[model samples]
Target chain A: MVVKTVEGSFAVAEAIRECEPDVVACYPITPSTHIAEDLNRMYADGEVKKYIAVEAEFSAISALIGASAAGGRAVSTTSSQGLLLMHEALFAASGMRLPMVLVVANRAVSAPLNIWGDQQDSISQRDSGWIQLYCETNQETVDSIPIAFKVSEETRLPAMVCMDGFYLTHSVEQIDVPEKKLVEKFLPKFNPEIKLDSENPLSLGVYAMPSDYQSFREDLELDLQKAKQSITRVQSEWNNLTGRNYGMIEQYMMKDAENVFVAMGSVCGNAKEAIDQLRANGEKAGLLRVRAFRPFPFGEVAGALNGKKNVAVFEKAVSLGGAPPLFGEVLCALNDLSRKPTVSSFIGGLGGKDVTVNNVAKIIVKIKDGEKRFEWV
Target chain B: MFEVRFHGRGGQGAVTAAELLAVAVAVEGKSSQSFPVFGVERRGAPVASFCRINDKQIRIHQQVYAPDFVVVLDEGLLDAVDVANGLKENGVIIVNSKCDASALNGKLKIKEGMKVFVIDATGIALKNLGKPIVNTAMLGAFAKASGLVGLESVKKAVNERFEGKMAEKNVKAVEECYNELKQ
Candidate 1:
């Protein structure tokens, strides 16, 4: 049975319930508050089990870390500054190889005090060693929750499901929510290979001497390297069950396209629409949606743009004086390709500047007409 | 294919209005897409949303420029946003206002042959829902003016969205607005 509803916050809560998460640790923040509120209400009403309201975002993640360590399917959610507060714990979660899932309501980091939508919060946490999946719609937001859990548990690394705040979080949309039985069928009980057990009394987070630290780090690197394949396998299994397929990257009308715009999150929807309109108007345009940002599907992305003439990377978050964050990654991914497409980086939608289809259409026209390094005004 | 843009403020249910319209169109077996272009706009600050309804799949992801219909949920936004910026010649403009349609024509520049429907949505909301939020009421006027979807479809959509007393009140408001348009 498919139920239609609005509000991504409630959608997240419903997905969490369908997944039957063993533990949910959350802290309240603007935009992200509704997600936690919905989850807490569900837990209080006995719709879910073990809802832990922590004092801070740090503690919220720490609780999930603890719960996951004890072999429970743990999850949590946060945004912007709250995510920054949990930065230290993020590294810890990755270092210990804990497969916890986090819902990051993407928000602009504050200094001038902007509570709007952007990707800086999640983009800044790129080095946190968690597998990040950006969602484009409320349906994708709900769909990614169960997928995140499966991917994280398979790779034994944390997964961050990021969506634009207010855009996907607070905004209401008609979302198709999967039934409980189907969700259960898709995602079975998570059983971690190595867990903290009192009977075994295994040592976790033990002090690593300087000499052995490198080897431990190497093992972590190997696990993350294996995550790329793991994500594909799990997503394939999920597709078999739900008939809704997702990937590390999803290419839209990219076949035989000359110009391609690469983006993630909700903006991809706008970009895809622009591409379709352009194509109908007899322009060769397409979109490349980066679903899995971490383990950064470099091979798949490079392969998608193999024959494209030009590519535009639209980054929602800026990297100070550097190139747009996602653009930089795209460049690095295609650095060694023998015949690479000319790439232009466009920085936009920062501090929540409505990146409309008009903006995307303009970008495509510019790229097709041979303008590079443009910024959406 | 028709694209409608709704301009209002945060907490005014502009996005909700778009979703309800999408559902109504879907009830007629037509394809529709409804999404909001969110901003840092707080309560009373200007926000905009878009809805596209067509007999086929809407593959264009662009914002609705040159919209066939424009619904102004808050008259106050008229000063800040040019609600008639991209209105087509045959388009319809539905506004929630107490002023006369000619008054809006004087204040705003619209193309010739474009239809304008003005309703005291604030008055309807005050009487029916006990609030000045005019999204639903203005949506009622939009359905009547544009004929994009039948009143029955919109009433069913509204009833599906709201429940009990609130649903009854909104359904009544929609029917009342429809009747007011008919006369």
Candidate 2:
């Protein structure tokens, strides 16, 4: 297959069409609209068998849940407020252990109204029991679709494939899209035995008595913990077919890094510039990009940050009235280390704000100056 | 690495121009990325876009702060925005206007050593494509002024983006403006 220059949304759409899911039900939202629109076009062309028309994000996920329950390989997409509307359904989809994939074009939640890129939408739902995978490039966005499907079906846990909304969605770049044969080889058709049927009558998601309620929640947690392994396995397996490697978290220039900045999604691109320039000037700086947010990858994150002199956790989303979410998590990951380094939390790029190379360089300087706690760039 | 910023109104094909340049560079076996600053801007609103071309893989996903070249599709944006912000010391400014390079230098009041190039792209676009969209025309001038992309590559890119008569007219717009541009 020849590499094509494409927008991130269009690449994801191509991957989705190649994946050939049984149903797609989504309400259009900014940044995420292209994904749904492209899928809609495929539906019009008879490439997809079912495309459900739902009124709201709430109904969108509910309908996908029904489709998955009826033995259909279901998929849907939403962002920000739409994700908020589908909150209950998100938990239900995972609680019932349904294998569905929700493509999230991550965007900022709004009180003042913004349509640009951010990680807040998906970060808010980090506890909703779905496997969250954050992507950095358009090529990664295309690859994550089938990897998502494979992992979701294997573990019976829903997965959210999140890419920075307009940053990647609107930007055009070079990417190699896998062919249909590779996709089919990677993911087989959804087996009917997984769904409800008259041949094998059973009860699911039934009301649990108090004695067994705690155990059910325990099982969900255990399944999620096991998902960390499956996520890594799928990435390696996909690498065999495509010759590209996507890790749970990526470490760049970490071999002798004295100061490290941790981030996710598109900001990593700018961070690389800061690292390169600082290294040129005899400074030891590096970056760690956390690709798997839901499973968290705490051990790998802590290991990468262990011996560094200082660390800065920067994010586009803030937890509001608390340490920013990513910062809090990184802190939790590093808390038990005997030789932990200085950790600081910084927030920038909120509400589609520009996360520039200079902003990243400033964060590095602040880390050197021994700044503690949160600072906005 | 060569960085460029494009200033224009929404629906003026500024983003399209950036993407076309990126595609052209990619077609030539280089790495490039292009995107709009006003990702969700409304039609007719002021918009800015950026592109970066490099022999190696270009990874930074930030706006073009210090651009090697800046293309202005509408002269009205000069008063409405800072058209000269963060321009390199020896940068080039390409404008789509009827004035000559000397008047553009006086109008923009650019720094010493900075070069200004002028093309009546709006006129060429109107004459050739029957519209005020000077993006492709400016791109043709950009290729000539910066010497980053060949004229044939620009024409092929424009042709790939548009179809039949529209593609032919846009290529004509590019050729006419690039040939007539004054520095």
Candidate 3:
């Protein structure tokens, strides 16, 4: 592990380069632009085998689908409207079971046309059949890329490693970039078991009538849930190699705590500090950081918040007229609890609003004071 | 942990300055984080960046609201933005201007006991780098005024950030600024 002080985006690019992808198809978007830029430079310098500068994000993902179908370890990075532009293709990539990786610098979608950090972009694609892993720090983001690729290949599903835009992606810090040999040992070359071959011609993503469509959907769902095991095993393997352990949900100060703040992405960092401050004031506050959002980690989340007095679910995206995305999921996870925690929903930090430690501590205090079921922090 | 906020025009290297400081902090075997205020930035718009240095891992990911030090890259920003807002008492403000302490005191609304250090970073940059980019020069003043980083570490960070003549010139600017600051 070589520790270097660099921008998070460049660190991610370096990690992706070490993965030695056969093809990288990308269209530049703010916050995520530096990754594409660095990879394109690597491509020009002959470090990467192929780099396709697509006109738009739709074509970028479409090109990745083709690349992955042709048996190449493919990857792409995008954010905000760019991810939205590839909405249809996202399902297509996953529906076809094309194992690939996408790094999303999570940003707010716009009718107001803002370019800032938020989880609304990736959260809106929750049903796209891709594994979603949110990161709280640059080192975790760097580590998640290789883990995403390994899990994607193992589960035959695509993975989106979501790092907060302008928060993690744009931040500069010191991180350990893993050695190429270690990654090589951890991840074997992408030799797909099946691919588009003219000699042994086969079809993929063919029309699935109602008779078979439901079963195919069920298979993908089951495989996504089972992929959690693969994620854990791979992450544990990575831990053994690097001494950095990660889990689907990181429980911070949860033991003997009555109240917990649940969140994803960089907001978890602020929440952790808030937990520390609350503990100082003799308040028993904990933080549950949801690293893997796709597999949903229902068992672990339910286990952690099983007997807590209050669970404040803070998220960057809302489900509009419905329950917020994460809040709704947490509610379901804790549904079978004999004594369910009073899980409150909070929607804040949208459009890159600074969700400071103070805001997080106050929410915990409000939860203690029996605040409403939902709030806009 | 010590937090520093930087105020500059969008075209200036405020963000890069913060990053350089973070890298220098790393050279001292400490952890640091730096980031710019995200926005649809233009060349001349007022912009801000932040840096935090600590002995352990810096886990907080929010902007530095109450900074221990404020570094202003352009004196023009003093009239345009609240460069000193949320600064803690006894904090230090380093400005890249020719103005002395009393002149800058009239312009800034700082709390009592908060020292204000003035350096002609532009002049230093012109003499050493032959450019108006005062980011590296300001960092040198920051190193001296804040006593958070060493001059050699800042020079090494500059060398890491730039190559060849650019690195040499920036290091010279850093040294000149460090020598110019009385603190």
Candidate 4:
């Protein structure tokens, strides 16, 4: 179907339909509410089956986990507090090696309570063991859902596809809705190696002493280590089908860049425009988009920034005592690299303060002006 | 290159106006960027949106300090924001109000070489869409004042944004706003 106007929520629904998930469990939250409503509508219309509107985000994930554990392809979505509410369950889903996909509408986590666009909500859960992909456009948001499912199920791990709230969520745009046949071809039916069944009767989540528990945790670490390669393989398959190639990191004009801004999610779109404008003016500035966050592609990032003289890492969330969370991760990634760029951290857009191209340009200028320190505005 | 700043309250479709303008410009094969800035995410809080359209890709992401066009969606915002602070010498100010352009201009103390255009967008929106939302209506006047985009493009964008009968109503509002500015 040709979709002329689509909100980020509906775009997600369209992708879910294409993926043909066996079960969809979601709770209603600001910005994400429409996604649930759209899926429910599709379910009611008989376009999609086995859609479950759950009571809470935790239950939503739990239900999907149960369904996925039973050898059914499952999906869920949440935002901000809802995502935080599902934190414990998120870990369980990953630990159990369940192949599920979650759609996260990135929203500001609150003490004062903000329901707007920001990355803190998802970034806060960086260590949840799920592969995280940040999207910059409505089209990317839609396309990522099935791709996420493909990657998640391929590795038998959960995945989170994140888009900014209200910015991509409520905002409408023209997006190409792929045909169901094409999606089916790209994402085949999900078949799991282990599942819940009466006949098989295998015990999961068994109590283990420290002796075995350490090895269990280590096994999970090994799987996470394997996910980096799995992501590359799955992305190749996706690219072969859709003709769009997205990696753990998407680099833009970074090959010859002197100054580069590292960003994730929708801000990279703005940052790309800033880089293009600066490049036109003889400023060798570019952007590196962090598409995959969890199995943090450290080597790829290090390689991308190897030749750059100055790098500015922009994070939407502050790390309280340490550098911005993303900055810390990037620095860790660059630890063993032969060439490391001078890294600076800048935090902005907390509670959705709008990081425009001008803000990024300012950072680039600061980097060029010999500012090696970190700042938050 | 032209930069426009829009001032309105949240939930008033201020960001939509900027986005629609950006899309329309992109449809014409030009480069444009639209983004919003605000603190209070809820409705009825002051919000500002910016748009830049140029022959080349736009890089500056800061809020427009010097705008070639100023679109004021609510008259109340005049008291709260410096709407005309950095308006270009030949810039035009479009206001969604019943007050005459000269009267509103005097109230704003618009600098010399600046032109002001005023329309009762709330009235038009109420008449056409049965809502007080004036973003689309103001966009129509924006097209007339700046001539950056065609009115047809605005209508198409509005039709694309809203669905069913609502899209028809918004398209009518776009036409009315366009004709109002023409007059």
Candidate 5:
């Protein structure tokens, strides 16, 4: 266990490299370019063997689909606009049941052409049938790699490790970069459910009749549902190996709390600080950080917030006409509960704007003052 | 958690300085993070970077509003920007200048209990590295002023980044500024 201060992107790249993948196909994007560059450097230094630098993100993910179908452990990385361009390929990868991992240096999608940290990019892909996990630090980014591969391979679902773009990718932080030998023990080689070989002549995701398409879609949804268990199981295995366990949600100061702030990604760190300050001042404030979004941990979220007097969800993206996507999900999670807290939503930190500790604490104060609100901070 | 922020022109190595400090802190067995902020950055434009050093994992991913220490790589930024805008109650500002600490403190008129440390880091860098890249030299002064990262670890981090004569010059620059600092 060699601990060192490294940038989040490089840490992620090293983690993926330690997995000893068969292929890494990716293109460079700001805040995310270092990930590909580092992986490419590993190849140049003879630390890796297979790498494919594609024309664009669309091709990057598409190449991964081909690589994964051919029985290779494949990986890729992208940010806001690149993720948007690869939208179609994203669904195809999952629908084809090609298990792979894609690291998302989460950034705000552009009209003004901004490149900074935000959750909108991955949040927009929540319905694409991919497993999503948000990371709070570079340490978590490194820790999630093996778990992502394990869960994806088990459920045949493409898993995404979403992290705040510049916030995590560009920031230098201390990470326990795992050894390749240990990671290999944690992650066995590719166990493809079906492999495509030239001599064997196989077909994948092709010639779907109406009935076949319906069942394929149903199985895809069912597999996504089943992936939740695999995610938990994989994390349990990782905890047994590394003694580090990050469950579906991380709750801070939630006991005996009257108000709670829920958030994801690196912003959860800010929410935790705010909750600590509120607790220090004798306020009953807490924080619930959702680590997983797809197969959106509804039960755990509802269980955590059932008896709270108020809950505030601070997200970085908007769902246009409706409430923020996370806020909407939180409401759904709480709807079936007998006890429900009035939840408010705030969209903040867009385009890399600062989401200060003071901002989160202020929202907690508002939630407790009998004010239910949803607005940009 | 102790927070620090750096202010300098785009061409200066303020961001690199912060990252190197984080690496040094990590070598000390503590958790640290560093990031830079810029918008349409140009040469000589004001750029800010932030670092947080903690005994445990730090969770807040926000800009340092009330930094325990603020490093000004260029003294010129003192007039152009509100360098002490959200400083902590007992924060210190380390400046790279040849002026006396008392004179710089009086000129800034910062908050009460806020200490100011001035060092001729630019002069040391010019003498050793033959140019005005004061980031390494100023880092040594930062070690003197903040006492968060050790001078030895700072030198090691610098050595890892540079090699041979370049590394030796930067290390000498750090030692000169660090030794000259009359804390």
Candidate 6:
């Protein structure tokens, strides 16, 4: 590993290059544009091959689906409206059980035509059958790329590595860029069970009658739920190689705490600082960051918040006239607990609004004061 | 930890200035982080970027609300922005202006123990780079005024960021500002 001072986008691009996918198709968009640009430069320099500059985000993923079905490891990067445009293709890619990787520099969906960072883009695709992983730091984002591919290929499911746009993508910091040898040791070549070669042409994503379709859906559900173990096992193998501990949910200062704040993405860093300040003042505060958003990590989340009386789920994506996406999931995770935590929901940092450490402290204070209603901080 | 905010127009290289500063600090074996204020970036519009330098790793991912130094790339921003708004007491302000310290100090509410450094960066850029890009020149003044980083590290960072002739010219601009600001 080489330590380099670079933008989060550069670090991610370097990792993707190290992974050495067979085909890369991308359409550039803000925050994610740098990754595509760097990879394109590498392609021009004869470093990586077969980079197809597609016409739109829809074509980008469609191209990946084609490449993966052709028995090749494929990758792409996009955000916001670009990801939204791929909504139809997203389901097709997963339903066909084609293993590929998508790096989503997560951004808010546009209605007012805003182009800033938020989780709305990927969060809205919760039912799309892609494994979603949210990262809090650039180092974690870089580390998770190879892990995503390993898990995706293992589970026969496509994975989305979601990093907060601009917050992590545009930010410049020091990160350890893993070498090619290390990546190769962790992730071997792609050897799919089936492909579309003329030597053995096979049908894929074929039409299913309503009678047979429900069984296919049930199979997908079972595989997704079982992917939690694949994620954990792959993370462990990566941890052994890199000496970094990662889990579905990371707990901070939660051993003895009554109030816990659960969040994901870049906001978790600020929440950790808030927890430190609150602890300095003699308050028992803690934080739990959800790293894997899909396959939901239900068991780990419940174990972390089992005895806590108050839980605040701070998320950037709202379901619109319903509980926020993460908030609803947190409720489901705690459903079997004998004494459930009074879980309050907060929706903020939409469109890259500054969710400062001060805001985090105020949210915890409100939870302490018995404010259980959903709030917009 | 030392936090610095850079205020400049969209085309003024404010964001690049912050990133280069972080790279320079990293060269000295220190941890630094930098980022621009996310929004619709347009030319000639008021913009700001932030940088933080510390001995340990930085965990906070929020904007810098209280900055130890503020650098203004355009003097016109003084009228449009309260550039020194959350600046810490005894802070520093560096600007790429033809006006002297007292002239610029008259516009800002300079606090006790606070210092301001003024350099004709636009003139220096024209003399060296043959253009009005003053970000690298302002970085030189920032180095001397704050005494937080060495001139050699700043020049090295500039050399790494630009190539051949452009790198040589930027290094010259930095040296001119550093020498001119010497007390």
Q: Candidates' DockQ values? A: 0.32, 0.74, 0.88, 0.23, 0.74, 0.85
Using lDDT, rank the candidates from best to worst: 3, 6, 5, 2, 1, 4
* CA RMSD, predictions in order: 3.1, 1.8, 1.1, 3.6, 1.9, 1.4
Which residue ranges in model 5 land beyond 4 Å of their true spot?
B38-41, B101-109
Tens digit per residue, CA lDDT, model 5, B52-79: 9999987767777788998999998888
Best by DockQ: 3
TM-score of chain A of each: 0.96, 0.97, 0.99, 0.97, 0.98, 0.99
Better of 2 and 3 by TM-score: 3
lDDT by residue (B1-183, candidate 3, tens digit) is: 999999999989998999999999999999999988887778999999999999989888987888999999999988878877989988999999997878987789978889899999999999988899999999999999988999999999999989999999999999999999987
Candidate 2 DockQ category?
medium
Q: Is candidate 4 or candidate 6 better by TM-score?
A: 6
Model 1 preserves the real interface contacts to a fraction of 0.26
Candidate 2: where are CA atoms >4 Å away?
A: A198-203, A369-371
Docking class of 3: high
lDDT per residue (tens digit) for residues B1-183 in model 4: 788899899899998998888777767767676766633466988888878888874433344678899899999988878788789998888888888887776568588898888888999999998999888888888887788898888887787778999888888887888888843
Tens digit of per-residue lDDT, candidate 3, span A304-360: 998899989999998888889999899899989998988899999988888999999
Root mean square deviation (Cα) for candidate 4: 3.6
Location of the lowest summed lDDT over 10 successive residues in candidate 2 chain B? B100-109
In angstroms, the error of model 4 at A230 is 2.3
Collision count for each candidate, in order:
2, 0, 0, 5, 1, 0
Residue A49, model 4: lDDT of 78
Cα lDDT computed for each candidate against the true fold: 0.84, 0.88, 0.93, 0.83, 0.89, 0.92
Better of 1 and 3 by TM-score: 3
TM-score of each: 0.89, 0.96, 0.98, 0.86, 0.95, 0.97
Report the C-alpha lDDT of model 1 over B1-183, residue by residue, as the tens digit: 899999888899998899888888877877777777754458777888888888975444445678899898888888788899889998888888888888888656788888888888888888898877677777678888987898999999999989999998888788777777632
